[model samples]
Structure formats: C-alpha cells, structure tokens
Target: MEIVQIFGFALVTLVFAVTLRQQKPEMALIVSLVAGAVIFLLMLRKIGAVVNVFNDLAARANVNLVYLGVVLKIVGIAYIADFGAQICRDAGEGALGAKIEFAAKILILVLAVPVVLAVLDTLMRIIE
Candidate 1:
C-alpha cells in the first residue's frame, strides 16, 4: 500500500516534471527535486522502524553502539549522496554528480576508520 502510494505519487510527479520541462527546464528540475524530497520524507517512518530493528539486533548480538551508529551514518550518507548525485545528473550536471559521489566515498571511508581499526586490533590480539 505504501509502495503503491509512492509509485502513484512518483508517476504524477513525472508527468508534471515532463510538462514543466518543455516550458521551463529550471522549474522542471526544481519540481523533480521537491518531489524527491517529499518521497524521502514519506519514507522516514519506515526508515526509523528499520533503525529500531537494527538497534534491537545489535543489542542482542552484543555489538557496540558506537560501531552501529557509525555504520548507520555511513548508510545515511551513501543514500543522501546518491540522491543528490542523481538530482545533479537529472539537471544535466553529470560532473557535479560524480564529484558528490567522490565526496561521499571519502566521507564513508573516514567514518569507517574506527570500525576497521577495531577489527584489525581484534585480529592482532587473536594472532598473539
């Protein structure tokens, strides 16, 4: 039902965006971006539910909250970056989209450092 709603909304948005694209290309892009934002907003409740499930799982598994938090942050960044990059590409700015993706990758790496370091440290202790 939610997906059906999302699809219906997207279809309507696509129609409007296409219509606007003919008369005012800039306006078309704005409409597309705003539609995307609305869709993301609509999905927030689902996202929160997923996060709660992950939190519960992490607790049961005895996983550190910090690492779980970092992982969630990384996923959030990836999704947001992809969304932005797609918008840029839609606006005929492929180069800008690529730059956004590059920045996101660097940020993900930075956020992952602590997790990587912890794994390596655990491995070292096991070997010793």
Candidate 2:
C-alpha cells in the first residue's frame, strides 16, 4: 500500500539523515529536504483526487467556483507554509520557522475576509 511505502521511505530517510548528521551536517539537511520533496510529490496525486472531489461537490451544491478557489488557495498556503517552517526548524532556525507560521496566519486571515463577509451578510439577511 502507499502508506506502507511512504512509511518505509520515511524510516530509511530518517536513518540516513541521522547517520549523515554525525558527519556532514549540511549534506544531512540536503538529504532531508530532498526526501521531503519526494514525499510531497508522491502525495500530490492524492491531493489532486481530493481537489477533484471538492470540485464535484461544489458543483452539486451550486457553490461558486471563486469561493472554492479561494478556500483551496488558503489551504495551499497553510500547507506550504507549514512545510517551509518545518524545513527551517530542521535547519535550526526556529525563529525563522515561527515567522513563517505567523505570516501564514496573517495571509490566511486576509484570504478568508471575503468568505467571512459573505457569511455575515447572509446571516443579516436571514435575521432581517
């Protein structure tokens, strides 16, 4: 199964990283980054399937594609930010990682503003 394969790859990478960390720290970081990229690429297919499902459901519910796109963008930003932050942390830059996360939060809030306004407007109409 894919999960098993992923786990196996992760285990092997962990061991290799650990071994390299004792010798060449820079190369160890590089290996970690490459392994992370590989895993991310492997999961992209699954992510695509999920996006397709969301699109189908949105169509059935008559939801606007623009809103869906915005939501997806927010999610994408969150994931990418998290990945980057993790990488920074692994490279011993905790402060940088924290900054990345903070920026991501601000970006998510900005992206969500329109959706929040739409919901508030709908609620006001219902109460009127």
Candidate 3:
C-alpha cells in the first residue's frame, strides 16, 4: 500500500515535470529536485532503524565500532554522491554528474584503503 502511494506520487511528479519542461524549464527542474529529495527523505526514515540494529549487533558481539563507522561512512558517501549526481543530471548537467560519481569512487577507494591493507596483511601472515 505504501509502495503504491509512492509510485503514485512519483508518477504525478514525472508528469508535472514533463509538462512544465518546455514552457518553464526552471520549474521543471525544481519539481524534479523536490521529488528526488522527498523520496530520499522517505527512504532515510527506514535507514535510522537499520543503523540502530547494526550498532546493537556490534555491541553484542563486542566488536570494535570503528569498522562499523567506516562502513556506514562509505555507504553515506555513496548515497550522497548518487543524490548529487542525480540532481545534476536532472538539471541537464550529465558531465557534472559523471564527475561527481568519479570523485565519489575515488573517495570510496581512499577510505577503503585501510581495510584493504589490513586484509592483505592478514593474508600474508596466513601464507607465512
């Protein structure tokens, strides 16, 4: 039911944007941006509970939280980059969107270096 309503809202927004695209390009862009933001906000309402569950699991397992925090940060960066790219594309800047995604990939890789190095060191120790 809720999904249906979301689809309905998106459809309405799409039509609104399409109709306004020619006569009022600015309004159309605004409509698209607002629609994306609304959908993101709705999705974020679910993300909070997932974060809490992850935190609880890490605590119960007595695992260090630093890794969990890094994972969450990576996910956050990906989502933010995706949102920014989408917004740029909606505004007719596909090249800018691609650059945003490229930067995000680089940042993700940089942030992941520690994990990668740790895994490599562990593997070397096992081999030795």
Candidate 4:
C-alpha cells in the first residue's frame, strides 16, 4: 500500500515537473524537492519499524547497545548521504554529488573503526 502510494505520487510529480521544466526550470526543481521531502517523510514509519525490529533482536541477543547505536548511525549517514547526492545530481551537479558520496564513505569508515577494533580484540582473545 505504501509503495503503491509512493509510486503514484512520484508519477504525478514527474508529470507535473516535466510540464513545468520547459517553461520554468526553477519551479520544476522546487516541485521535485518538495516531492522528495514528502516521500521521505512518508517512508519514515517504515524506517522506524525496521529500527524497532533490530532493537528487539539486539535486546534478545544481549549485544552491546553501543554497537547498535553505531550501526544505526552508519545507516542514517548512508541514507542522508544518498539523499543529498541524489539532490545534487538532480540539480546537474554530479561532481558535487560524487564528493558527498566520498565524504559519506569516509564518515562511515570512521564510525565503524571502534566496532572493528572490538571485534578484532574478541577474535584475538578467542585464538589465544
């Protein structure tokens, strides 16, 4: 149901944007940006649902919440970075989009380092 609504909304927005793009490029961009925001807002519920599931699983597994927080941060960064890049690309700034993607990757790596170190430590202890 949500996917169907999303697709329908996107289709309508595209048609409108296409019609407006030739006469007014700025207006088309505005329309597109607004549509993107609305779609993202609509999908937040689903994202929250997934996060809840993961939280429950982590609780049952007795894993450290710090790792879960880090993972959620990474996922959040990925989504935000992708959204920003897409917006830049839509505005005809592919190079800027690429830079945003690179920054996102670096951030993700930095955020993941602590978890990676913890895992390595655990593995070394097991071997010893």
Leading candidate by TM-score:
4
**Candidate 2 residue lDDT tens string, 1-128:** 98999999999999999999999999999999999999999988999999999999999999999899999999999999999999999999999999999999999999999999999999999999
Who is ahead in TM-score, 3 or 4? Answer: 4
Task: Quote model 3's TM-score.
Answer: 0.89
Q: What digit string (tens of lDDT, one per residue) describes model 4 on residues 38-105?
A: 99898889999999999999999999989999999999999999999999999899899999999999
**What tens digits encode model 3's per-residue C-alpha lDDT throughout 1-128?**
77898899999999999999989989999998999899889989788989999999999999778878888889999999999998998888999999999999999999899888877998999999
* Candidate 1 global TM-score: 0.95
Q: What is the alpha-carbon RMSD of candidate 2 to the true structure?
A: 0.9
Say which prediction, candidate 1 or candidate 3, comes out ahead on TM-score.
Answer: 1
- Residue-level lDDT of model 1, residues 76-101, one tens digit each, is 99999999999899989999999999
TM-score of each: 0.95, 0.96, 0.89, 0.97
**Any runs in candidate 1 off by more than 4 Å, and if so which?**
none
Stretches of candidate 4 off by over 4 Å are none
In candidate 2, stretches whose alpha carbon ends up further than 4 angstroms from where it belongs are none
Each candidate: what lDDT?
0.96, 0.95, 0.92, 0.96
